[model samples]
Target: MIFAIIIGMSLATMIPRVIPAFIVDKLQFREWVNRWLNAIPYAALGALIFPGVTTVKPDEPHIGLIGGIVAIILAYIGLNVILVVIGAIAAVFLLSI
Candidate 1:
């Protein structure tokens, strides 16, 4: 009974994830739809990161915002991603101290 329950739980978890991959591969989206879908990851990443940036120093939120701005400028300038991240971290650290 325990083994059966575990297998059932695995199937339930896997099905939703697996079905999308198969379906999306077989589907052709309109150009606008494709563009919208392509933007989702960046939107989601910003949503996830924005909150943390704001909360990095609750007493002085600007430190985080400045850090985020530094990161954005570095990225816009086409610095390597690692350098962008390091630059942001350095900005925050220097500002905090």
Candidate 2:
């Protein structure tokens, strides 16, 4: 059982990296797929952020998440990244406390 668990974890860790390297060379996704791939990170961020934003109380919610949304918007508009990150962190810390 221990061996199986270890093998399962190893496969879980390896497959994500291995699948891309193996498949990228052997297969071609269509242009539509390429476009969809560009949105995957945003989808992942949504998956992570949605639960946090919706689950917690207004008083003790994930303050960092709220600040991140603002920083992301500002960065999307081409603001300086360093300042945006600093501002986000500061906002979250102050608001949460």
Candidate 3:
């Protein structure tokens, strides 16, 4: 029963992601639509990050703010995403300690 349930859960999670790539690949999008679609990841990242940026440290919100600023600056300077995240984490860690 547990094994079957795990397989069922995996299939349920996989289907949505797998079906979309197949469907999207067969469709033609306009230039503007493609541009909008490309921006989705950035938008999603910002949505996920902003809340944490503002409240990562409850007692001292400034650490999060500093880390967020470091991330933004690194990203704007064309650093890789991993580097930007590492810079943010480093800033927060150093400041918090």
Q: What TM-score against the true fold does each predicted structure earn?
A: 0.63, 0.59, 0.61
lDDT head-to-head 2 vs 3, winner: 3
In order, the Cα lDDT scores of the candidates are 0.92, 0.78, 0.91
Clashes of each: 0, 0, 0
Write down the worst ten-residue block by lDDT for model 1. Answer: 48-57
Q: Is candidate 1 or candidate 3 better by TM-score?
A: 1
Global local distance difference test of model 1:
0.92
Q: Evaluate model 2: give its TM-score.
A: 0.59
Measured over all alpha carbons after superposition, the RMSD of each candidate to the real structure, in angstroms, is 4.6, 3.9, 3.3
Best-to-worst ranking by lDDT: 1, 3, 2
Q: Model 2 Cα displacement at 60 (Å)?
A: 1.3
Tens digit of per-residue lDDT, candidate 3, span 1-97:
9999999999999999799878987899999999999999999988998777778998888888899999889999999999999999999999978
Local lDDT at 45 for model 3:
87
Candidate 1 lDDT over residue span 37-84, tens digit each: 999999999898877887888988888889989999999999999999
Candidate rank order under TM-score: 1, 3, 2
